[model samples]
Target chain A: MNDGLMIEVENLTKRYSGHAAVSNISFTVRRGEIVGLLGPNGAGKSTTMRILACYLPATSGTVRVAGLDVYEHSEEVRRRIGYMPENNPLHYDMRVREYLKFRARLKGLSRRRSRERVDVVMEQCDLTHVSRRIIGQLSKGYRQRVGLADALVHEPELIILDEPTIGLDPHQIRAVRQLIKSLACDHTVLISTHILPEAEMTCNRMVIMYEGSILAADSPDNLQRFMSGHSQILAEIAAPLEELNECWAQMPEVEQFDVSPAEGAYHRCALTPRDGLDLRPRIYELARQRGWLLRELTRNRHSLEDIYVQVTRPEEEEES
Target chain B: MQAYLTLTRRELSGYFLSMTGYIIIAAALFLMGLSFVVLLEKLQLEPTLMPVTELFYITPFFWLILLLSTPVITMRLFALEKFSGTFETLMTAPVSDREVVLAKFTAALVFYMIMWLPLLGCLLIVRHYTNDPSAFDLGAVGSTFLGILLLGCLFLSLGCCASAMTRSQVTAAMISLVFGATLFLVGVLSSQLPLRPSWQTQVLAALSFFEQMHDFARGVIDTRAVVLYLSATLFFLFLTLRIVESRRWK
Candidate 1:
């Protein structure tokens, strides 16, 4: 067990009957690291998070949190971790402040300390104004904030959030993303989401899972860089397709070229650059020299979405 | 201990804050009051007659039916958390399964006491009307109250166990009601068996909640009845705790 790591999951597996929901998987989250568990639905992201939070036990292997085995020290692990499920389950009858204070006390805080913690989390989650209102009466956004506040009230070192922004509007999504980013300074966070944009914006590192197995684990930038070599450039020109293809093929930087008809008199072509070469400046110079109109020229940057597809693609496509 | 107290306090506060608690109390009181009026008229008894004692006699019947509604009050105790996603928050806290179950059970018991208060008031009124209220069967009344308390505790535990089995409140209530009714009816049906008087008494006594209540109604304070009620209460509570603990594995 690594003392520096806040969470350590080794060969963790959850099987329902004979079928595995989460196959043998392993990972570690060190203190102050914001890691994303990115996967599509049924990809076992939520199942893995639940095991780490001690809400559910793994069928096989071990999970340790705060240097304690989760199975042997569940109460200790629970005290050291805060978890927010995908549905944000809460008792709607209790007031927001009351609920948070109740949760703080359940985490074994002294009454005075619980109150103080509740106030701090209320402010952090922006739930102070509606602290006296019943949770059921609050809007979806405020209810979500209340859920986050309850999770933070005990000041756990680790926070596991499952699909935190599933139903939120754009503004609410941005707010939650910002809050998650701010939490990374003080707490280790493991957030699960199928939404690529949410993971890209809030997580510093991510693990991509497909069919209950981890396909890759690295920083977002590094994962994108993994798909960098097989790049394609798109260019639109208001010239004859035959002429554009001939010129694109002549350039030494352009390793391969394909031209297709565009709307009206324009033509579209894909230019594959040779090793360690950028063809944009060369293409611009060629357009200037030949008086050929260059309508558009842009390099295709690999996004998290592209990498998700690449990592999860079939074995045949993955090898190719 | 502190976590148990905190959770119990929250549950008790929830009962007072919501209409479910008030509604159950009001309904029980209204039925008790209506029955007192009809029973008084039929017996042609004075207002000072031991109306409260008669009212206590009918409590088990009312409780058997009213306790069915108690599940609606407590069905959301743990099930609501599971349904609304708040269970994830509770399960991750440092509290033990025993603490959580006991807290919720105690809260429901307290609410049951509050519901019984109005009937206690009716007893006080009976005391005021009688010339020799001290002659009244205070022993019987005390025993009856004990029976009621034990029965309430038993039902609450049963409800909690039923609620823990599912996330749906309606399903919890239905299952609890079915089980409670079966227990109540078994007692009634066993009494009609054409067997030796001693054998009949033994079997009917085992199944009969009313038989258990008879000792209390006579102010006898049967230790055996007390033990039976308590054991039943503990049995259901233990089952509820086990159900909650197993959830972590699933």
Candidate 2:
């Protein structure tokens, strides 16, 4: 029924002047899902997020946020979504508490309700320590936190953050990442970032784009599973590797295997799986029967980084 | 209504918090105080000085201070938001652009009024020291301030519209100066035009802010003058709203 979806975008496009900033793209975020919109620069990630936040209108196509059409019911949709734009601009002249209170009011909270929310968000974002500190005088990390607290002061159902951890140090990045992960308990969080590792660490599902188009949208696990060569096995074996290679090549589980003779009557070996099955058991069984001593056996699964690069690779030919 | 008040309060507090507000007020008061001293001394020599009828406080130099002061007070109204990238955050909030435009307009208008507060100090000083008990012309004083406010309303809106046109405060200030000076010159030069008889009414209708202020300083609050200033303010405020909305397209 699409009832559990928090965002539904179809054929959305945004064109500036004669150029299309965001070509036709479509994706969805289910309720309570931590979705990441990941892409390189100029890949329309910000434009798509802005459209979904109701900050910018799409050139064509329909987007619904919280079951409300972004174009026709923008105000209502805005109320439902807390959007932190790229760089997370804030009123630097204001104190953290003052800024949050004002933002709460602007988001349609009454004075008493706004005060309560100011405290709640400050506590949630861990901004209570700097609640009375001037935003301009705070460190960059503190300012980023204030921006996030301001976004959630109204207690929106969905939260959208654009590059939430763009300029943070390693420690601050970790803190912000944990804060985002915690938010998914009550919020449908959509984060847009070119920082691939950040997205992999935080998002449950990813929308990877390249050249103004979505190349893939799936869970991180599913994406890695979808890659044809997802894992590699490495081993060092003794006792005449040529005989073992002949037997391994005939095994059904071994997709391909390479063996190179090494010093002291040993061989370096590597193998890939043909099916989506772990070949460690079969390899061990075959080794026991063949009387070949297995010295080292290790398997490495494909990471999101590999799949991200494999899917969103830039074209060899540049766009004119 | 609460939303409007919240925006207005934020804007007003922004002035008191920023350096531009203090600089504009100081510059305006310095020039105003200079004129107040020079004019008071000059009129005292004539032995026929009245606190109210002395148009020195509301003379050409007064308009000069206004022309110089407007750009500073209103230059950052919208341009700063655009420059700081806060406009996106603000526009995406539940509030409408109309509320934003009005709130800023009201804040600039209020700051403009604050700049004129020093004029009151000058007037009260003139009245207290003068020998004649009937020296103060309340009507002239009231009407002159009214004239100042109406003119301030028009120029501040012009400055606001200029701010909306760009993301640079310096450029916004330049726009305010260009438009403010152009309108002031138009108002002054229209009367000097060698017009045919029928053109007199058209010139008076279109360009008479300078003329209106002259009459008001002499205790004339013409309805025509009031209507022109209010409409010009609304017109520019409306233009600002449109510019803000059009930024989404750009």
Candidate 3:
């Protein structure tokens, strides 16, 4: 059963009163990979993460974590998976250290081990300064850190965080992202977030979900490349439109071209490569040969945001 | 076992950590002290054949404190967790549903017992003043306190059940208060009704909490009353467990 896979979800479909929140989706996370479950609101990312965490039962299909069925071996699975649920609900009455200690014990750590782990997680999450402070009195970022400490106190192998950076400021978000990335050395992380750029930065792979089904699952780079088959080149050259059109026709690498006027008698041209080849060098060389002054020649790359919009736009059309 | 103890300790400390717990204890002790003072005043006016413990247990103030305080004590057992969304974390832990329900029940019962400990101190004050060895009967005091414990077990479980059903502490308290009042009134009113057959009167008397407390104060240990309280407590606790488990299906 040591298949190097930390999570295995098979044809999972979670329905609520005849509505499918997760409709027949499947994906896997390899050990040591920080996989991000990316989707818009109401796209079932939370539902899927909840099932993998064993917090909710799947309506149909099976989910296995660390090679054990989540339903049958729930306690065992729970022992190995640390789940920080959405909004990071915690006891506001208790002090940070006290709450973490209690959670550690509840997660089946021995008293001494719980104490040790509590201190470790406090240091790891940078909550050691506010360890004695009441959670209710702390700020939202500190409270979130306490929640993360609670999850990590048990030393679980797989860490599942649902929107870990949802309400954090930029600095705190960056800090939390670093903490999540640091956890990958000893733990497999599965984080669900709607923040596309955050996933693009932290995840080794992204699982794009839309309307309860996974549209794509790959590295951020691969997703961007696969979603859009061809790359574009933008060129601003001091040349006549007629000559530019003629130059575009001569180059077979340029599939389609659009030209518009720029500043001081300069013309801007947008070119799509037929085989996704680099048209930048070719355009630069062509301008040199034709004695045309090329001011700007740059490749237009697709971001993860663009790919996400492209993947989900078709589903929106079908629904409409 | 460890999870149960940890959860119970948390639940018990939760009461004292908040103002609601301290407020409940203060209000209960104040009512008990007032009831004791009034009872002593009434005793001074005329000597009665009834024992001091019997009179103390039968007061409307005693029932009022019992009925009202049980709901407040158990209302936050489940409702507060649900309100704060911590119930999701609690239920997702590796603990079983039964352990959670039982831990909460045990914590509430312990807090209830602690709230009543002052009543014994009030009785001790009376004994110290009277200076008579036979002035306070140990058997009567023991049985009266036993009756309080048993009734608290049943009523507090009802409160736990109500709390588990909803996320609002006020609604949970109100629901359990209605439950406790209706149960008490049915037994009290049934015993007071006239023109009832002997068999029916006997059954009503058996169900009457006032009658049970009277017997307890007289040192009569009725196994039937004991069974009723214990069984009803378990029944309500079972209902609370089911309510906690219903989240998985819903």
Candidate 4:
């Protein structure tokens, strides 16, 4: 039976001779969801992706792709999953069109279908311009697209990319990110990257892995909120510390406040809201009522980096 | 089956599209031409009972060409994929490990056979110029080609096994070179050494690739040699398949 789930991994542990690469990790991805396996280097992201793509077998536990057990139905799972491995490895000697067509045919497409998909994927990946050029002669960005085109040529149900944007310039990264975002309409994407901005921008949900185990799994917004109970607000005003303390005490939205002296006459006041409330307007109105010189009034929301760092800090500290 | 054919075509085109394949063919042509001229001179200087095919197949240059070219042809089979990081993409395709190994072996063996095609051309050129109908027997030449094909199968499979074991093409070539040289050396040493036991002599004689080639050159179809080479080829291919599958464990 084809369930709504595209991938189902439970208690998956991949152990090398000396150590485990992925240890008892469990996660799932629904169809048509862009899920990011976010982790740093040596975090077993590639190892997990490899296992899911049927390139590597797990030492223990089970992985199912499209309701088929990966170990037992590897050929079927591989036919359904298009995997662009780390570094986007490709045949350097083959031209783009030739390579994509070869990959399409290898993935079980008919001859005419392979040709049609090669053209379609080449256009989708913006590789139409360099379709005749040798892959070894192409730039890194074009090579990355060619790898992407190869992955997409067969029109697989699931696309797994490991560090798809790595080693690309900002422009290329943005383009690749947009391309990945567009793929979510038709296919389920399970991309792994250490770049927080990439996950924040492209992925609908993220599973943060650290030291071979999943640390957290949620949407970016929920992760930020769950990591810290409430968001903080920063307000710098050229007013006395006692006045700021009295002003903060007056507003119940300001659950906690700390005032530190700045250069000249400005005082930096950090306030944590009691709830997930926008305290910036209230702080601005307070400054106007008190006739205080407001230099800065802004909500200090946690970026994905901050949440990732906070989530991964305990284990990093334990290792140290 | 389609995936296997596609992979085989890709590998065969890889050899031809690059300069390595042409260089190999050119070197084989030169070596074969030189050996032919040397054989002609030796024949002109003295008469012998051996047929032209027997003399041509028994030349040291023939064995040297086979020994050297098979490694170069097969070294890039799996090692280059691993080196370029395409092994993941290749293995992740729907094809099984057996197909992957067999495709590479078949491609290399085909290329090896193509590399020796110049010898037939040399034979034809000699036959045309001399206008001698009995210069080289067609049956002997056919058996000689069959013997070469069998040996090519064994050598290419051994080289494929070596290539599957390592990522470095140079290391793969060296390993297969060692394997091929050891096989040849055992044959040579067995013939040279005076073994007292009759069974030992019979076994070594059966194992000797030189003896096998000599018999085939004389149009003698020895089923023992055919079975031995075929079995060894299968054994090496089985080893290569295991090596390719070992990546799952690694």
Candidate 2 per-residue C-alpha lDDT over B62-118 given as tens digits, one digit per residue, 9 for 90 to 100: 878989998888998899998998988888887877899999999888988998898
Sort by DockQ, best first: what order?
4, 3, 2, 1
Every model's Cα RMSD, please?
3.9, 2.2, 2.2, 2.4
**Residues forming the 10-long window of minimal summed lDDT in candidate 2 chain A:** A311-320
Residue B102 in candidate 2 has what lDDT? 92
lDDT for model 3? 0.89
Tens digits of per-residue lDDT, candidate 4, A142-256, equal: 9999989888888899999999999999999999999999999999999999999899999999999999999999988888777555678888899988988887888877789
TM-score of model 3 relative to the true fold? 0.95
Better of 2 and 3 by lDDT: 3
Which scores greater on lDDT, model 2 or model 4?
4
Query: Candidate 1: lDDT of A203?
Result: 88
Q: What does fnat come to for each candidate?
A: 0.92, 0.57, 0.69, 0.85
Question: Which stretch of 10 consecutive residues in model 4 chain B shows the poorest summed lDDT?
Answer: B126-135
Q: What is the lDDT of residue B1 in candidate 1?
A: 98
- On DockQ, the candidate that comes out on top is 4
Per-model TM-score versus the true fold = 0.87, 0.96, 0.95, 0.94
Off by over 4 Å in 1: A233-298, A313-320, B42-55, B58-70, B135-138, B190-203
In the range A1-320, model 1's lDDT, one tens digit per residue, is 56689888889889978889999888888899999999889999988988887888889998998889988999988888888988888888888888888888888999899989988988988888999998989989998898888778888899989889989989999999889899988899999999988888888899999888989999999887677666788888888877887777677777788889989888888978876355788778878988888899998877889899877777887578
